[model samples]
Target: MSKICGGIFTSHVPGIGKAIAQNLQNDPYWKPFFDGFDPIHRWLAAEKPDVAVVFYNDHGLNFFLDKMPTFAIGAANEYRHEDEGWGIAFARPFQGHADLSWHIIEHVVASEFDPVMCQAMTVDHAVAVPFELCWPGKDAFPTKLIPIAINTVQHPLPSPKRCHDLGKAVGRAIESWGGNEKVVIFGTGGLSHQLEGERAGHINVDYDKFCLRNLAPDPEALLQHDTLDIVELAGSQGVEILNWIAARGALTGSVRELASNYHVPISNTAAATVLLSHSERVLA
Candidate 1:
């Protein structure tokens, strides 16, 4: 059976990708944020997971307001990255694990979660930036990818509890797959920041800290807040933490934080990276 190695939760601010493309990692403005990935680099080197199942939000590259699925999973042979007007150089296309993608799609649907299944998908920075952060200086990402997009771009988004439940369902599906591939789950986007409105440029350090503290050990504690509450506290875009919650929910094992970094004002968002290791499946 396939084994889930662990999960990585991080912010996917577009500027990070620009900084990386420009080779600005050691610059004073970018050092702290860039340094956070050191431990993650080491962990990836050691684990060498064969597949990466990414949970991220699409930023107008794949879906728009007229039509967006609450959940979308890719069953493509490969996923291409395109210019999203961010001016960041396009990263190479990522190879896909179509067999595993179909398996997850089938399993989740059987578990009563309806999702859009894509045979071909275009990934935006939400998917590319995290892969770059985790494995820098690579021509192509080492692991085959399965991109699962959640709707954070429109109203009536999935609630925290619902996202968490989806993650749990995905975890079960991964473990039950009849393959020996080692997999890593990625939950990408947001610590806290709003890009527009009167609350624009808002960064809630206290709230971000609260989330970072509880997310790994007691994700249930976060379910206490509804989606509206999150928007109010973390800012409209900050609600992207829903991705983090889902990623955490997927770790159906005894989990412990191996490394974490939280820094403020990275492109006006609270930039954070967390690397968690899972041991022994905790039967659902």
Candidate 2:
């Protein structure tokens, strides 16, 4: 059984993760976030976690409206970065964690959650951007990654209950994996930001605050409310909480908030960042 398991919650607002990485290295607004992540970085630097199972959704950037996978697992050797409808593309190609990834796929299959396995997958900003923030250097962050792809941008996304079930299965698989000591799970996405219609630039500081508060302790309350209800309360794109629910489930113990940051009216969306870890290795 794996000895240690934890989670990192963050915002992938375009270049936001990169910005935080810089803050860890320098900037003022980002220092707290960077500081909170320091133990994580140190843990990464020391334990050299063998596997990192990351959960994120794909926008239209990689999968389009015509064909979308509710859940996809990339068993590829490498992943390329792409644009989010913007002219600019992220510069690096992300490396995949193949061994553990395949292990996870097979484990999930036996457990009855059959995810589509892709030998070669191209990830968009949704996955790449936040990763850039979390692990700035490709050569840094020692673990191989298992990318859990969720679809939130397209219409008719998966329900909260479905995502929650997936997380439970992920926890079971990780617990079953006969592995080394280190493992980190990440759920990357939003805290109440809408990216469509005149509702663009919508600021629900109240909703965002509620989410940040509830994310750790009362997640079920958030989950109990329907996805449509959350979307209504949190704007369409705001339904990204499904990703976090899965991350929350993957963790071994209670959730602890280490650091948090929120800013509003950035381009067409409200932006925020949150860093959380499982309760156990609080000192690490």
Candidate 3:
């Protein structure tokens, strides 16, 4: 039986996790963060997921404004860095696993979810941050990655319902895979914050926590709302909540809240983290 080890929701605010993980490597606030993750760490150590299907958004790094996709999947054997306008600082271009990725595409499409297939794509902070967090020290994980890129930075963005539908497709796809390796489907993004234009330093702990409370099970309830509502209440860029809905759709039943941490003001972003695993019942 294939079990979803768990899911992680983090802000890929470029160097946030890297810095936090490094600081926590030998610090106190680490407890607020790392300490909560002990159970997940133990689980990770034990289950050792063989693959992670990640849901992230790109900031016009790989595919430019020239042609954009609402959601895209890598269909190549290897993916390289796109200069990112700063050249490859992290240097090692992220590699892709074709067999499993193809399987996801085949199965997801069979479920009627059509995702844009990418052969050549570069990545930006959205995708980079999460990968670095999950595989700090680089070769630590014995898992292959399937990146699902959502165009969060650019508009005419996909509707919340669309994202949730994609999530259902993703979970269904992974469940159909005929493999023995454990897989963790992660959706990376925000709880609540705005980092652009005039509203730059936005932070609402109450809203962030409220989101965490509703996110695990009642996320579909959010889809009934629209962009105007989100931009007005959660900040324009805060529309990333769609990423979380997509994640929730993939994992049904109960979810165990593993680790959670929230921080204010981190390099043009407000940040938060939460780890969830499929529970026999709802997370408590």
Model 2 global lDDT (CA atoms, 0 to 1)? 0.70
Model 2: residues with Cα > 4 Å off, grouped in runs: 17-47, 84-87, 137-141, 265-267, 279-284
Each model's lDDT: 0.91, 0.70, 0.70
Candidate 1: minimum summed lDDT over ten consecutive residues — where?
A: 83-92
- Estimate the overall C-alpha local distance difference test score of candidate 1: 0.91
Pairs clashing within candidate 3: none
Report the C-alpha lDDT of model 2 over 8-101, residue by residue, as the tens digit. 6666666564464344445555454445455556555555566667889887766766768888888887888765566656666666767767
Number of clashes in every candidate structure? 0, 1, 0
| Residue pairs with clashing backbones, model 2 | 17-133
Q: Candidate 2 deviates by what RMSD?
A: 3.8
Q: lDDT order of candidates, best first? A: 1, 2, 3
Which residue runs of candidate 3 sit more than 4 Å off their true CA positions? 17-40, 80-82, 91-95, 138-140, 279-284
Give the residue spans of candidate 1 off by over 4 A. Answer: 87-89, 282-284
TM-scores for all predictions: 0.97, 0.84, 0.85
Prediction RMSDs, each to the true structure: 1.4, 3.8, 3.4
Top of the candidates by TM-score: 1
Per-residue lDDT over 174-240 for candidate 1, one digit per residue giving the tens place of the 0 to 100 score: 9999999999999999999999998899989989999999977898998999999999999999999
The total number of steric clashes, by the backbone 3 Å criterion, in model 2 comes to: 1
